[model samples]
Target: MSDAHTADEGRAPRRVLVVMAHPDDVDYGAAGTVARWTAAGHDVRYCVVTDGDAGAEDPETDRAALAATRRGEQRDAAAVVGVKDVTFLGYPDGRVETGLALRRDVARVIRRCRPDLVLTHSPDRDLVHVKASHPDHRAVGSAVLDAVYPDARNPCAFPELLHQDGLAAWTVPEVWVRGGPVTNHHVDVTDTFHLKMTAIRAHVSQGGQSAEFEETMRARLAALARDAGLPDGRLCEAYLRIDTR
Candidate 1:
């Protein structure tokens, strides 16, 4: 719940790693902020936890085809935000688990990326609204937090990551969890909202083009920024800061 923002002005720009459960999760939530970060010359990497095989509408689409299509879409979306390094763990689309195996995998990425800040789905999900609180999102978010904490920082927690993966222990100073009830910080992304929209649009195979859907998405982000006292036309992304130190 810390409001302490990391000042990137004086120090060398640090890498920012964003982890999500699905292909379009970052586009729907964190793309704007990611655009801002990349524009600021920060290195940004995306780690997608799922293959998103269940995201297509055409039941005739095979799992392999769906996964390949989603990977391409995610790459296109990531490119929109200037994110070139994207990793997909290939976990089942809707059945991510917050277990040691998953935690260790996340920790391996954190250690390899050595990010100063990590972003993932909000832990305190909206229970009343099932659409916004997907179980996979919750699972990935929780696993990322665990990986960022004692797991990633403590050498003993995931020693294999260090030995086999050439990843050293890394302690991310801050974490930003999006799409939750307990928002404590907002980033002004008006300049990048278009890029965000483009990123979201790249997931066309996932049915992101409906007029109603677009309007609702824009309105929600606008309302979120407004509620945080940001100016009009200043689109924003909100987060709950989890400071490890």
Candidate 2:
């Protein structure tokens, strides 16, 4: 962890690519910060590794239909934050693995997006919040990290992308990881907290619309804001900021 502060300032509008394991992962983790970025004119896109086919609490649910529904919900959620473009890789919901195939797929997206920054879950597990350290989340995070380093930047790693698809190698300059063990950056999302809540609520299949859920989320943000040294009543979203440049 570096320092608890906001993101890079005074930079021009940047292209940001967010990679997550499931549909509402971004909303639960860093939607507030993302809202702030888009409000500042950044171009943000999402690459959801899975369509959340296995998210339903009921095991008898139709997974294929659930996947389609979740994809639509994610798009609606993204629209609330001013983002439009979203890609779903259609990987199995609960069985994601940190393997070469996953890395290659993420690398392909990185090369295509050519984003200045990549945001994703932390590869590390959080003991305090075990749910944040889901296997799929860690797997996707690890794959994205691998893709950001050598795979996405090295054209030799995926020859097909160069010869067949013509997606030139792209180097992501920075990465912001959510649900990490430590947070070095904080975004004051008091202004856009409503937007974040709206985005979360858009995932109707996830059932987060209750007043108690909102209260719990508010308490969590308030605690994080205090950790960030923000004044009282301020809401914040925190991340582990890493410089890949």
Candidate 3:
């Protein structure tokens, strides 16, 4: 669908929840935005669907060890931007699917957090970031979107979560899609850009330490800021703002 936008359509959400596919996913795309939100006293939580076990390049890498390593890295990275609570769903990396089970898991978090704003990858595959729009990313985006809509708002859809888990239904007013192929909204992250880079660099197992990775990210964010019509040297994160409700 083409992006439809209303500039500053509503006030910034007071409570934000970020749900993504893997350990480094949020930091890579929306950490700066998260920093901006937290600095403004908004409550933000991150939910990672995968354990990142399959992120290693070498076949000899231990999958179990890699998953554990990535989890710790995510926590440290989140801390850099004042996000203290992160939930890891522990699904196998590269094996996520957009299905009922995944939807239920994401819905549970939504019901519990009851966030007004949700941030996630584009539900559609992003041609712009071919590598980032992995099978896992697509799956999580689809599931999270499902969770945000009727599922989370309708307790009848997931009775187990309501009856067994005692989590009530929640209505999230809006969802912002990060790294979409088309962008209609942007967050000027000039002040928090350094914090974002620091958070991204915490993912040591995922090339966060590579100079090339850092350089590429800087260039990308700077370009996004320019395209967003921010000051020439400003840094920003772009999104397609989706009003889910």
Find the candidate with the highest TM-score and give its number. 2
Q: On residues 81-162, what C-alpha lDDT tens digit does candidate 2 reach at each position? A: 9899999999999999999999999999999999999999999999999999999999999999999999999979989989
Listing every candidate in turn, what is its Cα RMSD in Å to the true structure after a full C-alpha superposition?
2.3, 1.2, 2.9
lDDT by residue (tens digit), candidate 1, 1-245: 22422224345677999999999999988888888788778999999999899886777889898899999999999999999999999899888989999999999889889999999987667866566579999999899999998899998897788788778888899998987767788777777778988899999787777778767878887887788776676567788877886
| Candidate 3 per-residue C-alpha lDDT over 108-149 given as tens digits, one digit per residue, 9 for 90 to 100 | 999999998899988677776787678888788889899988
Which residue runs does candidate 2 get wrong by more than 4 Å?
A: 1-4, 7-9
Q: Which structure among the candidates has the greatest lDDT?
A: 2
Candidate 2 global TM-score: 0.97
* TM values, all candidates: 0.93, 0.97, 0.93
Cα lDDT of candidate 3 equals 0.85
Candidate 2 Cα RMSD (Å): 1.2
Tell me the spans in candidate 1 whose CA falls farther than 4 Å from its real position.
1-11, 210-212
